[model samples]
Target: MNKHQTIEILLGLLGTLLIVFALGLYILNEPSRLEQAQGDILQAQLNDAMTLYAESCAVCHGLNGEGIGATPPLDSGALRTMPFDDLYKTIARGRFDTAMPAWSKDDGGPLSDYQIEELVALIQSGDWNETGDRVVNLGLAPLIPFTTDPDPVLVEAVGSLPDGATLQTAIGIYAAQCVACHGTDGLGTGIAPALNDPAVREKPADELTRTITYGNAGTLMAGWSNVLSPDDISAMVALIQRWDEVPTGVIPAPDVSIPTTAESIALGAELYSANCARCHGPEGQGRPIAPPINVKSFLSSTTDQALQQIITLGVPGTAMPAWGDRMTDAEIQAIVGFIRQWEATAPEVAQPLGQASGGGGPPWLRNAANATATANAATQPTATPTSASPSVAPSVAPSVAPSVAPYQPGAEAGTGQGGGPPWAQEQAQTSGSAPLDWRVLALAAAGLSVAFTLIASGISSLKKYR
Candidate 1:
């Protein structure tokens, strides 16, 4: 046969095989199709049920299931976890104490057994469970304007721990909730850091417990406070501390052997901007995660030794990370000394920090958004990690206090004042970069190359024949 004829034959065979395989695949997926149809019917029923819930229940229970003030929320873990039968009983026989009325037809209410079943199905649908918040957010905020919620309550971590009296029982909680991210050995996993690391062990028990409870914000970890009881969290901390080799707990102040000379102070300022500025505020002026080191109250209260310990151990449960593992004793001391210089700058700092819009603060202390903006906008005094000049002071400014109106969520966004959170200003910097995704272009090129090769081969064969 000629090359073209052979090619046609092969194409015919390929088509035949594809048809057969397609039929087989369709037959194989019969059960799945049936299940999908069933799910669709159930979903339609859920939609109808939702309508009923919104009309009847949402008033007192909230627009969603989030209960209004005084009224209990319906989107509760208990409701999601409870057995259908138990839930049905509760719906039919409304709570005697609470405002929740009986909706069951048997109790002379409006809803029939089927409707109650539908509502039960909706609740059991897991709308408020571990991964349901995303869908919930869609229902709550479809437009999501920037000004709507500038300062959202950022959840630090997620997942729950089972209640247990002893530390041994607490391991089960870690196995179920945390083992995926942290790993069974706690040496760290791909997603999370090792729990047994010196940084984790040396943290104060209260701090560790708080971390477990709140979870870390700006990460996938959800605060387990909703799921785990205070006792459960404490138990986890105890279990974690036991893993430490040096017997976990307060790390003593390391030697402040680093001289506090001009050269050292300059180096310390540079280091603080690079390492400490992110969480501890732009320059040790504390933020939501860390308190201000430059503030009069902070400097006056904490000793140099205590500052060294804080820098090494890091305050528990907050964002302040331990420098002990990364930084030397001298480096930490230098940062401490840089912070001490601010003692003189406190009044200057506080005067600016006082509320801008007459917002009440620590009474004597002041805070204004304009001050925050000025510190942020000033190009010269800004914290420079890359270019540290001995002459230039670290321009790290205190994070706006939550109490200050300028720092409030409703404050003017992107105005250099309390515009949104600190991240808002950074948006301008991040809005540029790789305009094209090389991965996608590479894939397209690969597909085209294959097609070109096939077409060229066919033409080459035809030419040879000619």
Candidate 2:
């Protein structure tokens, strides 16, 4: 073949090779791409499931599904080994006469079918460890349930019983499982019925045993059968019969002393304005999205630690995100101080929280938007304060705005006041230039090489024909 024809032939072969190479790259990357997409979707699903669990399940089951005293753990091998349908049913319809409420909307619970399915998947995945890490990263406490020795006073009180050892064991169980509702003396709280009542004492041992084993249906009480053995249930029943022997003490007065300072309060105010003022009203009034934290009902009822924990963990199923992830301990404490200040004059009843008005999305989005605005503002010309000189007379502020400040590499961007979370700061620092894909570059180069060759050949062939 002539030079031009030879070139054309080479060009066609080059194009063919390029196509083959690109196809090979696609083949190699396809599985990984598919896997990555699937992983991303699964992660999103897990996050949603975690949120649901924190809101609904975490109180009864420990934060990481480790399970509280009598609550069976979701993170266990038993859950992972469970059949999908059984698991789905357990979460959806719930167990009969158990605390596991029917979560599915069909069963009159809060979650939809899809949400229940997501929870089931979460349980099956056994990813509570990672979920816990995510929660900690957000600055919330893990709230892992721990076993503590029974109160000496409680142990001493029941020591005189014939089965003192059994009663002692039952005290530990009661302290761990039932004391929250039944009180230290079993008088009962607002939520749970009094276990020390004459009516309860009058009930047959079998009836009480059945109630504890099966749980009081349609109530917050969950069956302890899975957690407590037959003997353990018997001990609890025995302890209940001798309830009068256990002395009840007066509940201690609430501690109203919340330590804070002018400086902390001031810092908290700034932080609140930047972070919380949107969802929580500007003046600590309630909003549709957030409750009135400043009102007496909230401030008086919630302890300092409780308030801190709530801020740190966030209220799941609500707009509240775990502030622990975003803020430091000092910052959170400062915010608590700021909120607590209103208690002295706080209204007894919370006024109906008003809906959010004016422009902007949720608080998180507002933070990003505000950050961008702050960055933009920093770039705009500002009145740089003039220093008084010994020799030269200074003008009363420069007539013309000084030329925009020179960009310095590694200089702090935005306000540089270190406002916002550590993550936001890290994001700001990262240039975010993704690594180059050699496979893509190679394909592009090969195509260009072939195209150049073809153009040269065509030009040569046309000249020869002319």
Candidate 3:
């Protein structure tokens, strides 16, 4: 038999075993390689679809599907969560109320059902990282750029509030027409004016009413007169005025209170600085391109209902974009609270001269001043003014005679000839009067609080019933 034969056989067996082990290792790794290949294919398909989305949908949906005004965002949106059938139906049917045109012939647009399906898939299934447990970038989907060109007719139509409309109704109207440019917080963004500024708050009711009704010419502001009735204008003005009166240091709603939540107002402050400070300004002073938000006038004027509606629905025309699909209702509410909190804590600014006058200045100047005041009130001040004056006095006094001076015209041994303009004297008298009738404000606040409570209860009940 022989030792030589035994050794040869053993060597042969070891060689065979080594070859088998190498083959096993290759087999074990093959599935991962295949999976990688499959992922690459999916990513390529997604890239193609995203490219298509950019080319075909970006104009309306936004580059990131954040959606321009009127168009819905597709990124991790309701459409993404909706049943494919419903999604298909919406795309096919098109929303008549908005500019979202039907994509399928069945409804009216140019795309086919298959294309719609593909788009939906690309939006929903596109993973940010292929190798790392397929996590979807929910934030990425709704990152549509905000748009400003809302149809003037649409703005007017939506801004119109029927007589006796509730604050909620008024808010809904603003949401459809103002939130985009103004942001859900009423803090100005891009090319919009803040609705909460002291200057705006101080504007005469009539002037404010006129601005809302007629809108600023040659600007993104669209006249809502065609859509809103005079009564509606009055209601809106009333609302704005109310916001203007909110106390300078009021707190945010309880749910959004920084002390009680996982996310602090401090965090919100950081977020605002990063995401909102540029357009809104560090102190929320309305920039030339934006508006202020921290003034008492703005907070007092806007109701919570209105704030929520604006956050959810957004303004249709103009640069304001809808965030309904981008942020959760809770998140939006938190943001609203954050802005309100800012209004409460932010330093106050004086109203502008023209705004204090009630009516005699250029419309644009008035609008700008008002918008600035409103926007500034909501962004916590990076640098608050050392002294808060009620008004920003004009640099140059008017050339009116001493007799016409608003404060003191002439003084001859207290003959009263030294007193300022009659109107100025009257204003002084009023200013010297007792502080605001807190009892009356309290009563109004109580009444509004009750009304809101009831409404909330009813809504809760309805949800339960459903």
Candidate 4:
């Protein structure tokens, strides 16, 4: 063969080998590649679902699906083993008369069908460890639970009952686990049915046991089989049955009164205004950024210790910050004291200015208002326009510049102050979704490189033939 023909033959052979190699590689890796792609899609779905769960569900269900208060755990084995369709329906339509609201858009919820599916998949197969890690990375860790001892007066009251020992044990169990939804003495709250009612007392012993063990389906009442021993549940059931024998005054009001002098309250007032008023409202009325602390229900239900602890540790996954690191214990106590003073006169229900959740408020406004207020308070007389005063304005201007620039009507989007407009800000905040896997990108780059090599060889061969 001629040298050109030989060259052409060599190029053809090389191209053939390359093609064969690629085909063989693909054939060999097809199953794994498909699995990886599916996995990537699942991961993306999980990330999206995690965001939704964090925003809407985590406040009650917990950041790690660990369950908070009376809410049941989502990461439990029972949910994992639940049929996909059943779980999907539960999320879509919600459990009847429960806190688990219908999430699908069809049922007047915010989620679409696809979103609901993603959440179902996440619950069934997603890694809770990964979910927890992501939440922590995003600084949305679950709140530090209230760990204070039970109210001494309540403890003493229970201790003096007819069956003091059993009552004490049951009271301990109830206070530790059950009191969140079932109010003290099993009177029931907005969330759960009253155990002290005649209906519960009239139920068969076996039925009561089964209900406590297995929990009422499609309700917020979670089974105690996993959390409490059979004995503990029996004690709880016994406590419920004996409610008729127990007098009304047996369970006295919890004494959470902190010794707050007028001066301390005044200091707390100043501190609350300076730190908490922007979101919680100036008079403890609910604002869009926070729930009302001044509401009668809140003040009555929440003890002074709880209020202090909540302030100190802050609620996780919410905008409420942990003042433990920022303020002294005394300061937090003072703030709680200030909040406690509103109990007697607080309205039965709050007229919240916006949603009863925090973190949805315009952060820029809060920051700007605080900045402006501080600046105004600290404003000294301008030094008569001296050259030094020109520098002073420049120095002070930068401090306020970032806060002021974003609010201007004509400011460029995402250019000056607070990252962008409020909508843009939300978009920016939520832009950290899972990205394409590196392996996929690598494969694409490799394919391009191979194609480029083939094209170059083909062009050279054509030139040689000409």
Candidate 5:
């Protein structure tokens, strides 16, 4: 009894020890799985934050966070390496002297602290190699305002400008220098504020001129004082002042001429069809993917100077590719000229008209005209009835009577009023007689004669007629 009891007790104790060991192993592995789940959740949140940052911040920070002009770069930047708390504060507060716009509520940007935290985490976690080089923290001083009064010599030079300089002339100057960042229409791009908006328009004339001449502090807007004389600055100011007054309508001075020689427009047509039809459409009516090159819209929306700039420097961070490298300046100008010519000749919305007979027919018409002609032919009366058999004709002749004559070559074809070749006369005699409109029949005969004459003339010119 003692041995049996002892054996049973020992087995129970061994089973309990094994169960405890298994529980201990499970406990040891649980934390790792939990940590892995947390890491996955964090990564997902980071991805979402990165997407928002790209849409909102990447424009200024650059696609890979390689900042341009005034906006500081973010890839492994000092700001990124800073303590999380300090980084959070700076993002919330925003730097004052630059275009590094505050993105948090306390600093006037729209992001919440939680969102900002997520963004910061994502930026910090990004590999510098994959993203870009680390931004240097030079701790450069903020741009200070001018302390000295305007130079008397400069003031006098600006004051000497004639009061009658036109805005168009001023825009030409701006296009050469300022349009890259400020945009062709004065609507700001990536790191720049819009000059066409009310905020810029409301600024005093002198302030505007000073900003243009001296440039804004801590921004990419470089001082143009070196490039442009004070007088030129004054002209620019006058132009900006008149920006509101400029008429929003088409000006007709630059009349583009289409070459009368078919070769030139024909080459242009082929080029336009191949390269531009995808976005601008076969007729230059813009699709949703691209802006309209329609004449009225083009004239109203872009100045001549602006068009030149856009062709020269493509917009950044957009699908608009630069053609300057591929196209010669003369080629660009020619293309512009062609576009202008198209606008002039295009039918107005109020007065719709088809392309002129010589101007190459409307694209849709050219594409479908042959198919439409074929369809019409199916219903038209042919020389012989398709269903009639020569053997059975006599049996059915009385019921489906058709007047026919023996075939003869040029033997006074029926109603021989229309001038046609000998082959047409033979055809008329063999086929059933049907009434044909004299005018239509005559037109067809004349057209065929002209075509054959041209063919014969071509052969003669080629010395193959003998």
Candidate 6:
């Protein structure tokens, strides 16, 4: 036989052996490779879903799903126990008479069914149960949260309030200044814990004042000592002290005479406005620091005696303050009278967190808004935003189709169309879903080239023999 023929046969045999070995190795590792691919796809889908949530849902539902201004909490115990399908439908169709718009492409908001599923995965994820408690401010919305410091810079920037600030004046301070996170009455909302907590009042006056001045380090709590005058800070501290006097969550009865005259009621109004309005809105619209006294159920459920006690004693663990000496019995009654007057036009506030069970607000509202705004998403189903600046509206009505291009070959591999990103486009050329593995073809081509060269050399040598 010619030398070229023998060499050719040897090359062919070597190629066959390599092919067999390669196939064997592939077969052994295929399952793990497929599992890895599946995991990657799931991860990618999750990333996309999270991005969508942040951009679309976070604005209202809260960055962490804890409710914000009138928004309900998503992590509430009631919602945690809710069925998956019901939750899906709510997210897709959206509730009427409320701010929640439909999210499904079918309904009109923006998310695809697959994306919604990922959102569900996010809601049901282990980390989602971060709410359900009013005081524990984990996963607060806006992440960093609003900080108020007494820094010279911050104080200079915001400027100072007038001197001789009264508790009523501080009420505005707590309301306009503090309620964004603390809640109206200081029960603690989704963002910050109750400054009304006895622990705060129990702390040394200097320590508390210093903490408020510098703001808490490594925490969302900012200090206001610099921005506020010593008198202003004193007024706030005094207001907080009133809450400490309350025996517990409920106020204890005392021997003070209840006032009812128009003059007394007027005085109470001013007092509530100056001292309480900051935590409870001037209009009595409860804040992160307190519960809404304007709520219909709150009025009906609570008694005059209880309200009076609250005015006199304040709720120890909460934001309510004791009036024991700061004001006369008539004055405490005046504050109660002011709250009573507000009840007449309180605007049917949503039940405070945890109390919606009988109040008819969504069960979620019972927790701070449903840990405030995002949680009640299931709860209040009734609250809405305060004429907020229009956000980048979510996907839009699902029924309307968004324009998109048709699929093409190597789209996933990123080669066919505009070739995907650099990596993806290259994948199609090599280890991709191209039907035939490119590596094998490459090996074959290399082998053929070498074989041909050898054959040509052999032929020339044979010509000499001839």
lDDT for residue 426 in candidate 4, whole number 0-100: 43
lDDT of each: 0.49, 0.60, 0.47, 0.60, 0.46, 0.49
| lDDT of each residue in 232-315, candidate 3, tens digit only | 677677656555332221111111121113232333454455555455555444444555655565554555434544544544
| TM-score per candidate, chains pooled | 0.25, 0.44, 0.27, 0.37, 0.35, 0.29
Local accuracy of candidate 1 as per-residue lDDT tens digits, 245-285: 21211111122222265544665777776776555555454
Per-residue lDDT value at 251 in model 4: 33
Model 2 residue 256 CA deviation (Å) reads 20
lDDT of 6 by residue, 1-466 (tens): 7876677667756666666766665676678778767755655555445555544554356545776656687656777677889888988766764545567766545578987877776666525322211011111223222222222332232223333235455554665456545543444432355666656657787877876665554333545643577777777776676643322212111222232544445556667767875665445545566655566655554555356545544544555665532544334445676677756654454435433223333443335442432332333322221111011011111101111111122222211244333323433354445433655675576567567656765776688699
Top of the candidates by TM-score: 2
Give stretches of model 6 more than 4 Å off: 1-7, 26-37, 59-87, 95-101, 108-115, 124-140, 143-466
lDDT by residue for model 4 (255-323), tens:
335546454566578779788977777777655456656666567766664565467556556798866
Candidate 2 off by > 4 Å: 136-440, 460-466
Candidate 2, run of 10 with poorest lDDT: 383-392
Task: Judge candidate 6 against the unseen true structure and give its global Cα lDDT, from 0 to 1.
Answer: 0.49
Compute the lDDT of residue 278 as modeled in candidate 5. 62
Expressed as tens digits, the lDDT of each residue in 201-268 for candidate 2 is 77899999998886665444656776688999999998788766654431111223334545456657
Provide the clash count, candidate 1.
Answer: 19
Candidate 3's displacement at residue 214, Å, is 34
Model 5 per-residue lDDT tens digits across residues 132-190: 21111000101111111222343343333554344555655655455444443443332
Cα TM-score of candidate 2:
0.44
- TM-score for candidate 4: 0.37
Candidate 3 vs 5: which has more TM-score: 5
Better of 3 and 6 by TM-score: 6
Off by over 4 Å in 3: 1-4, 84-98, 102-118, 127-466
Between prediction 2 and prediction 6, which has the larger lDDT? 2
